[model samples]
Target: MSQAKDQEMSMPSSRQESDRTAAPSNTKSLTLNSTRSGVGTGNFGGYGMTNGAEKPSVLHMIMEALGLRNQAQNREPTSKDIGTLIMLGVMFLLFVISVTGFFVMWFTEYYNNTMLENLILAENSDTAKSWLNPDPKYDTLLKAHIFDYPNIDDYLAGRADKIKVVDIGPLTYQEHTVKDEVSFNKNFTVSFRDRKSYKFLPEKSSIGEDYVVRVPNVPLISAAGPVKRMKPLERLFVSPWIKQFQEPLFKELTVSEYLWGYEDKIIKLKSLGRGRRRFGLLMSRNGTSVDSVQLNTGEDDITKFSIITQFNGMPQLDYWEGDECNRIDGSEPSMFSPHLLQDRSTVNVFLQVLCRKVPLHFEKESSLQKSSEPVLLSEHGTVLAQRSDQRHQVLRGCAHFSLVPALLHWRSGAVQRL
Candidate 1:
C-alpha cells in the first residue's frame, strides 16, 4: 500500500510541472502570432497583442491606444507630461496671434491721426497749402501780408512788376458743428521804439505800452461765411482749441490814406512825402474863429479828418493847431520838412502801410497816454494802419487780409498785377 501511495504522489507532481511549462509555452506562442498579425494589419489593440510581461493597467491601456506606449514592449506616458504638452501648444499659438494684433492697431492709429488727415486736407483745398513757397512774387506778397508791411522797394526789386490776383470762391458748408472747447493763457512781450529812427526806447523813457488781451475758453464754430465777419465766439465753436499765434512773430506795419479834420469843414491840402514831414494849416469853422496848427503828414494824408472813428473805440485827436490867413494852393499839396518822432505808439502801423511813399520822420510828438518811464510808447514801433483802430476796439476782425489771396495767386505761378 505504501508503494502504491508513493507512486500516485509522484505522478501528481509530474503532471503539475508539465502544466506550468505548457502554460508558459502557450502564452509565448500566442504573443508571437498576435505580434505578426498586428504588424500586418496595424491593429495591435484589436489583436490583444502584448509584450512578454504583465498586462498594462487602465492608465497603460489608454497610453497604448493613443500611440504613447509601444505594443511590442510595455510602456506608457505619464498623465502630467501629456497634459502639459497639449497646454503648451495651445498657449504658443494664442501668443503669436496676440502679439501680431498689437502692432497693427498701433500703426493704424498713428497714420490716421497725423499723416492721413494732412494728406486729405492738402489735396482738397488751396487754403491747406504750406506757407513756404519758391516763387518770388508769392514770396513777397506772402511776407507782406503775413508780416503786415513789407518793404515795397525791397520786394519789387526782387521780382518783376506784374502782380497776380487769386479768386477765393464761396465758402463751403459743414455737416457738423464743433462741440469741443479749448482754453489757453499766454503772456506777450511788447517793446517800445522810436517811430522815426526805428530805435528802441530806454526802459525808463516812459515810451512803452504793455497790453494783455484775454481770449475766453470756447467751442469751435463753422467758418462757412465771410471770415472777416465771423465772430470770435462762433470761431471757437468750429475750432475748440485757440491758436496762440495767428499772425507773424514780428510786428506788421500797414499804412492807409489819412483824412484830417474835426467834423465837417474842408481844410488845406497836405502832401505826405517820403519820411516825416510837417505842414502848417489855417482853418475857420463858419468864419467864427481862426486857428493855426502844424500837421504831421504821411502818404495817405487826407483833407477832411474825422476824429471820431468807429473801428475800435472813438479815438479823439488830442491836439491840432491851424492858421487862418494862409491861403495855400489846393492843387499843389504843400509839403513840410521831415523830422523824427521818437518813441511813437503808432509807428508799427505806419511801417505796415501800403503806399507809394512812407514817412521816415515827423516833427510832432505823438505818444500814448500811459508811460512806464524810459520805455517810450514810440520805441516799440508803429501800429498797422488797417489794424490801428482794431487794437483799441472790442471787435475781432478776420486776420485774413486781402493780401493773402493775391499772394496765393502769385505763388500759384500767375502773372503779376502791375
Candidate 2:
C-alpha cells in the first residue's frame, strides 16, 4: 500500500509536467493559425506558391471562362459558340441589307420626282404643241375672230373697222330657244377741251332693246395714254366641284377705296321672251358747255343721265349681287325667264360697264395696282330700253361695248373700277 501510494505521487508529477508542455504547444499552434489568417492563403499553401508567386490576372480568368486558357488549345467548337458566331454574322448582314434598301428607295423616289417635274414643265410651255389639237397650226384658224383683240385701245381706235358688226341670231342655250324679249340701247359721245382733258356724255341709253348709238371720237385725247384693259375670262368662274370644297385656285384680295367714274346699270331679271326687239336711236348733244372743275354739262345738256325701269314698283335690279355664271340653271334654259308658274318668283341680275383691271389668270399674275403693274381691261356697260308693264313681269337685260377718253370723263361715279 505504501509503494502504490508513492507511484500515484510520481504519476501526478509527470502529468503536471506534460500538461505544462502541451499548453505551450497548443499556444504556439493558435498563434500560427492567427498569423496565417491575416497573411492570406499564400502562407497556407492554397492555390499558389507561398513565398513569391504572382496571383492569376483578369486575362487568365476570362480565358478560363471561355475555355481558352491555353494558346492553340485543340478542341472542337461547342454548339453554343457556333450559334453565337452565326447570330452575329446574320445581324451584320441584316444591318447591311437595311442600309442598302433605304438608299435604293430614296434614289428611286428622287428620280421619279425629277421626271415628274420635267413632264409638267413641258406640258405648261406655250411653245409646246397642244395635246388635243396636235398640230399647232390648227389652233390659229379656230381662234380667228374680229373681236378677238389684244387690248381695248386697239379695238376702239378704228382697228376693228374691218369687222363689221353682224346679227348672229338670237342667243340660244340648250334646246330651249331664249323665249324672252331683250332690248339694249346706248349712245355715248366724247368732246375734248385740251389734248389732255375730255368729257363723256351719254345721249340716251336704256336697259331693254337693241339701240345703236355711236361713240363719238375725240381726236385730242384718243391718241394719248394707255387705256385700261381686261384679262382673259377663262378662269373667272371656277368649277363647282372646286368651289364646293372652298378651295381657292387664286389668291384672295381686298382693296379699300377703289375709285370709278362710269355709270352702272343693274337689272333683276324675272323672265325671258322668244323674240328680241332691236332698234337704233341716234341722238346728239347739240350744244354741250362742259365745266372741267364741276364736271357738269350746264343747263343746255341734252344727255340722258340715267335710265330706270320698274316692274312691281321696284327697280328692275334694285339690289345687285355679283354676276355668277354658274348660278344660272343649266338644266333648263327657261329658268332664266321670270314666267315660272310659281307665284312671286323672281331672279336677280346685274349689268354694268366699268373701267377696271380684270383677273387674267387664277394665280396673281402681277401686283394688285394698275398704275404700279400691268393689268387687263374690259369694256363694260349695261343699258336697255324695254317696256315691261306690271302685266308682264319679265325683265330683259343686255350689254353693249364702246370706248371714251380717260381725261374727258372724270366724274366721281362715272368710271367704275374693281
Candidate 3:
C-alpha cells in the first residue's frame, strides 16, 4: 500500500488536473517534493483539498480505521532529520564491513598459517637469534639431591646391619645454554653445538656446597671390582697402585668437591693426558659442548620440527648396540607441534646427556590457570605422564640408559621437557 502510494505521489508533471481528478482517491496523482524522512509535501494521505474538492473513498476509510489517516501538512526537512538519515546509513555500512571481515577470518587459513610461518627458523630472523643465543632468564634449571651415609663409621665397624643414608641436599642451579657454531643447512635443518654453564643459587638450596658429608668411595670400589676380575699376577700389579692412594671404603668430602670436582690419584692416572687432576660426576660437563647436534627447523614439514636428525654427524647412534635401540631420534626439549598432542600421543624426547630418547606418554588432560587464557596440560597446572612402568633400559656395548619419568609443558609457541 505504501509502495503504491509513493508511486502515485511521484506522478509525471505532464498529467493535468482533470486526469488527477479522474484517478482514484487512494492513487490520486500528486507531486512528491519531500524526502522520505521528512513530512509529505503535496496531498498527504490523499486528504488535501482546495475549497473541499476532494471526496471520501475506501483508501480514506482503511487509513482512518488503521489510525494512519492524519491532517495534511507540509514542512521542509529539519537539520536534525537529515543528520539522523546520514548517521543510519553510516552505521549500516560499518555493520556490513564488520560481518564480512569476521567471516573471512573464520573461513580462511590466513591467521593460523601466518603465525606458523613467523615461527619458522630463518638465519636473520628473531627466532634464529633466540635459539642461537638463548636468554639466561629462561626457566631451564637443574635441581640435584645427594644422599649421605651419616653413620658411616658405625656401619663400617659392623655396629649397624645396613648402611642408612640420609638425604642431604636439594642443590639448585640455573642452567644457561648457548648454541655455538649455529648453521642453517640447505636441507631445511640446523646444526649446532651446545655450550652449557650452571650458576648455583644459594637461596634455592637447603644446604651450602661447603657442608661436609660422608659418602661411598666410588674410586676405590670401581678399581677393586676390575682388579678382582683380573688374574693373580695382574691383580698384584693393579693392587699396588690401589693401595698407594688407599682411599677408605667410605670417605668424608665437602658437597662441592663430591659434586663438581675432587682430587683422585686413580682418575688422574687414567686420564693419560695432561688433564685436570680433579674428577667429579659432572665436572667435564660444565661450559662444554660434548657433542654436535642437527635438527629439523620445521621449514618443510612441521611434524619434524626440532627432531634430532643427527648427533655428531650420524643419523643413528653408534654408542648403542642394536639398530632400533641406537636410533638417534626424538624432538628437542622446547619444540613440539600442538597437533601432536591432539589424540594424547606419546611424545619422545632426546636427552643429549642420556645419549637416548625417553618416551612421555599422555596421562590426562589439564589446564594452566592464568589471567590471559588457560593453557591445557596433563594435570594440576603440570603435564606429568604418570606411569606404573616408566623406567627401562636397553643394553648397548656395556652402556645402558635408565630412562626416568619426564614432564612436558607448553607456552605461547614452544614446548618444554622437564
Candidate 4:
C-alpha cells in the first residue's frame, strides 16, 4: 500500500516539470510574432486578466472607453480647435497694424507743426515758378540779338543818358496798392552841401511775388507781372562793333571797379576827347545816396591838422600783374593812403585798364586752409568820420558835402549809372 502511494506522487511531479518546460517555448513564439505585426513588446492583458508590469491608469481607461486604446494611434483636430488657432493669429496681426498707424499719425503731425516754421520765417523764399498760376509770358528771357541795323542802334541812341539814383538815410517806408500788385516805396531827403535840399521820392513797385511757396503765417499771394523799366545807361548793350573788332577800341570801367581811389583824380572815359578824368570823389552807392564821409573842421586848415583821413583803395595793377603775395592766393593786396581830411569818402580815383592773368599750374594742391585765416582786405569801417569837438583841435576847412550824381558826373565824370 505504501509503494502504490509513492508512485502516484511521482507521476504528478513529472507532469508539472513538462508543463514548465513548454510554457517558455510558447512565450518566445508569441514575442517574435508581436514584433513582426507592429505590436509593442509588452504583455497584453487577456480578458479580465492583469499584467505584472502595467497598471490600470485614468488615461488608459479614458482611451479604452473612447475606443482608441492602441499602441499606434492618430488624433485629428476638431473644428472648434481650428477656429481657436485662427482667431489667435488674426489678433496678433491686428496688434501690429494698430502700432504702425499710431506712429504714422504722430510723425505727420510733428512735421506739419514744427517744420512749417522754418519755411515761414526764412529770410528769402524766392521761388521762380508757381504751379497755380503758370504763364510762359511772364518768364524772363535773355536773348542774344544779331545787332544788325536800326533796331538796336536806335534803341541805344534814343535811351536817356542818365543813371538811377537813390538817397539812403532815415527812410519812411510806405505800403500801397498799384495795379492789383502790392508795392512799397521809401521816402528820404537829399541835401547838397546843406545849401539846397529836396525830398527824393521813389515810385512804388511790386513786392512779395518771387515764388509760389506757402507756409504757415506767411502770405500766399505773390507778385506776377512784367519787370520794371530800367534806366537808359543801366541796360547792358553788346554792339556788333564788338564782333567786328578784335577788342573794344576804348576801355570801359565796370560797375564793380567804379569806386577807385581815395583822393581827387580824373579817370579817362571811353569818349573820343581827352578821355575824361574823374576828380574829387566817388564811392559805392548806399541805397539812393552814394556812401560819403564828412569831417566838420571848425575854421582850421585841414592840411595843418594832425587828424588825417586814412583811406584804403582797390588792389593796384602792379599787384594784379604778378606779385609774391598774389601768388599765395588769388587775392591782391589793397592800397592805403593817409591824407588831409577830404569831403569825399575816397581819397583818390583810378582809371580802369584791360588786364590778363597767367594761371599758375601746380602739380599738387597745398593743404586746405581754415576759413578763419587772415585776408589782405581790411574791414570797411576802421575809423568813423566825426565832427570835431573841444577835446581835439581841428581845422575849420573840414567840411562834409553830399553832392548830387549830376554834379559829380558833370565835373569829374565819376558817375556810374545803374
| Candidate 1, position 135, lDDT | 27
Over all chains combined, what TM-score does candidate 2 have?
A: 0.18
Q: Residues 69-132, candidate 2, lDDT per residue (tens digit)?
A: 4534533455765576567669999999999999999999898656433322132333112321
* Candidate 3: C-alpha lDDT: 0.68
Error of 2 at 149 (Å): 26
| Candidate 4 deviant stretches above 4 angstroms | 1-74, 111-252, 255-418
- For model 3, residues 299-326, the per-residue Cα lDDT tens digits are 8987777889998888888665456556
Candidates sorted by lDDT, best first: 3, 1, 2, 4
Q: Write the per-residue lDDT of candidate 1 for residues 2-91, one digit (tens) a residue.
A: 999999889989999999989999998888886676863345455365445354577666566667667666445667747855676699
Residue 403 deviation, candidate 4, in Å? Answer: 22
Better of 2 and 3 by lDDT: 3
For model 2, the stretches where C-alpha displacement exceeds 4 angstroms are 1-16, 27-53, 70-254, 257-418
TM-score of each: 0.18, 0.18, 0.65, 0.19
Among the numbered candidates, top lDDT falls to 3
Worst 10 residues of 4 by lDDT: 217-226
lDDT of candidate 1 at residue 394, scale 0 to 100: 28
lDDT of each: 0.30, 0.30, 0.68, 0.29
